[model samples]
Target chain A: MIAHKESGERIDPTGIKIGMWLFLYSEIILFGGLFVLYAAYFHRYSESFAAGGEELDRLIGAANTVVLLISSFTVAASITALRLHQRRRCICLLLFSLLCGVIFLVNKYFEWGAKFARDLYPGSETLVGGEPGLNIFFGLYYIITGLHGIHVLIGMVLLTVSLVWVVSGRATAERYSMLDNSGLYWHLVDLIWIFVFPLFYLVL
Target chain B: MSNQSLEQQQQEHLLGYRQLAVVLCLLLLLTVVTVAVSYVDLGFFNVPVALAIACGKVSLVLLFFMHLKYEGAIINISFLSTVLFLVIMIGFTFWDVAFR
Candidate 1:
């Protein structure tokens, strides 16, 4: 293991953070574009969209929201713990956060499974033969949630790397941007879910 | 990298367990409130109310969990601009649709 001092290189925290934020900006716009589509489609088919929303399981949606929110909190706390030089606590919190991500994905799997069983997916007979607005609704549902699920998987990978680095002493109290930035990415995932849950499940 | 920088690092705010827990509780509470409000059938206000609550929840996540409160100006402006762009895109689409 190359010691941080032996490397003779310094991490610019501010620069690293700005880069991450810039990347997050793009993610926002990416999701934002989809939301714009949702807005336009909703304006055209408000009644059908609302009716479609009524059939979704609100209980599962709310449960996933709670899970992500809790994960975000744990990620934030883990960073704080690292800064405080509490390594064990940091690892525990990060593991918990990863577990939260797993739970969220499992819930999503079942949720999508339920929809598939109902023949509600895009281009399926039910959606294809349904009202046009319901078509758009389910279409948006699959695309948005599927894309978000990919992000959750990406986040879990980032978290795992962060944990490994932290354990290896690559992420120390004096320098922990790896873990810090990982936490930020995790929060962005959670942040997107915060809006997504309400838009798709609560409001539609 | 310097001693002064290390000094500043030590001084940086690290929220305690209690405080982070409080933020979690607040987020969860907002979730419950939003879910409850959805059942009321508030006519045209339902969507708006739900979106408003969502914005509230996102703000909390940004300010605390994302540490926007402690971030520098560049990041703050970057995030703000992204939000501005999004609002304009969605708003303009709605405006165009409204007149149709």
Candidate 2:
């Protein structure tokens, strides 16, 4: 319950952390709904879904998994650094995490671009046309991955804001609740990928 | 607490950092195991094996990296409830779809 000298703002770091946890719960449900839909359809077309999943490039998925996992580690390390009052080290780790996030998005861009070029996208315009089940599987695939990508984008922005907070001295060892919360968000992004990796790559 | 108490905080911070690194190494090991296991033709057990490994990795991250293990029980309860509700929702959906 420390008070800021200049602004007299009572910094309740625990409250902010809890708020972020609650928000994370909501996000879980949001994505949980999409997962339910995917599972439902997947049950109906298990073979088609497996076939569609096999069509995906495992190397790219593996690389992206490695990238996101590294980013998660960097962000976690940044939180530890911030807690230690090592502001410079914290900022460096945050920057590294952010760079990893960018690499993930770049990989995703190329992956999606290749899929688009091959017309593997959902809807009637799919390249592998005439197969109803495959089309449905691809439809769910796009929706789920698209939503996960949006979450990654949001996580990147949150990390950027945290980076600014560090540079501006708004965040410090005693006042870095924002960095902790952003770390949680970044971990969620990674968690989603954990599920995605198996569903789209290994399950085939 | 005085701002000058930064030194004490630094020690605790190092402890946290070391714990995080240990957990990260474990995670990497688990990931490697998961990939290796997937290559084997375990048939029906494949999904379960992958998911079991994933759950272990997630538990490590949640407990150590996210500090949920040291946090108050209330936070754990809150997270658990959310997971329970999610399970119920998914179960209901499955029952409805499968039965129909």
Candidate 3:
């Protein structure tokens, strides 16, 4: 029953928090489907999966891991800044997080580009002489990583929008639910990367 | 609206920074452990070890960085349900793929 002095707005923070949680739940399901697909194909092509995974540059993956971990920390700090009502610091941290996301996508671009140059675009194109295991492995690789890259792209856009809100004064310390929710979403993006890094790059 | 200064509010909020730093350090340690353990020829234990470390890191992030520890039970329940549902889906898919 707290009232806003300026516009006389009454807010229920709990409701919005729950709404974000629900949204996150749906996202988990979406990613879960892709994970299942990956697991199925991995089981089918254990050796090829390992071999194809070796083709991936571990250094790049590891660098991206550091990048994302740093971004996650920045986003966490941003949320703390928001709660502390430090508007400038919050905005700066959010911008830094978004920049990190862009760097991740750039890395992904090079990784996928290398695969494409090798004529590894999944499906029949992925197999040179009908190696079923390689075919299956590449197929799952494209599907899972492709979908994940798209999600990261979306997250970048979400973070950019939040940054814009902060710049425009639409998001403030007292009414920063949007920023908080977006931070959660960004953290999830980073978390997914944490799993993806090990699964795709280090498992071999 | 009574009287607390903005600086005081900011300082109070930063009180958790030390705890966050500790968790971050732990996460880094776990990451190193996961990578180092991966090099060992433990057969099936390799993936399990990596996954265990990953789970531990995730727990730290959720409980500390995300402030889930201080949040209401509703948030915890919601997150748990999400994880549970994901497990069920993954299990079903595993069964279908393994048997077929």
Residues B13-98, model 3: lDDT tens digits = 44255666677677777777767776676887766677777778778777766667766678888899889889999998899999
Q: Candidate 1, clashing residue pairs? A: none
Once fitted onto the true fold, the runs of candidate 3 whose alpha carbons sit more than 4 angstroms away are A1-5, A123-128, B1-15
Residues A1-204, model 2: lDDT tens digits: 344656676776656777899998998899889879877887788888878877888778878887888788889999878877788998999999988988998998998888888778865476355577788877777887888899899999999999999999988877778888999999988887877887777774
Which ranges of candidate 1 are over 4 A from the true structure?
Answer: A1-7, B1-11
- Residue-wise lDDT of candidate 2 within B1-100, one digit each (tens)? 5653753443234346667777778887878787778678798787778878888877877877677776656678999999899999988999999999
TM-score of the first chain in candidate 1 relative to the native first chain: 0.95
Please report, in order, the local distance difference test score of every candidate based on alpha carbons: 0.88, 0.81, 0.76
lDDT of 1 by residue, B19-64 (tens): 8899899999999999999889898898899999999999989998
- Candidate 2 local lDDT, residue A1: 32
**Which candidate would rank higher by DockQ, 1 or 2?**
1
Question: Distance (Å) between predicted and true CA of A23, model 3?
Answer: 1.0
Worst 10 residues of 1 chain A by lDDT: A1-10
Order the candidates by DockQ, highest first: 1, 3, 2
Error of 2 at A124 (Å): 4.9
Q: Report the C-alpha lDDT of model 1 over A1-204, residue by residue, as the tens digit.
A: 112354787557777878899999999999999998988898889888887787689999999999999999999999989988999999999999999999999999999998899888889998898799999998998899999999999999999999999889989887887888888999999988988887888864
Model 2 docking category: acceptable
Each model: TM-score of chain B? 0.87, 0.78, 0.81
lDDT of 3 at A189: 75
Q: lDDT winner between 2 and 3, please give it.
A: 2
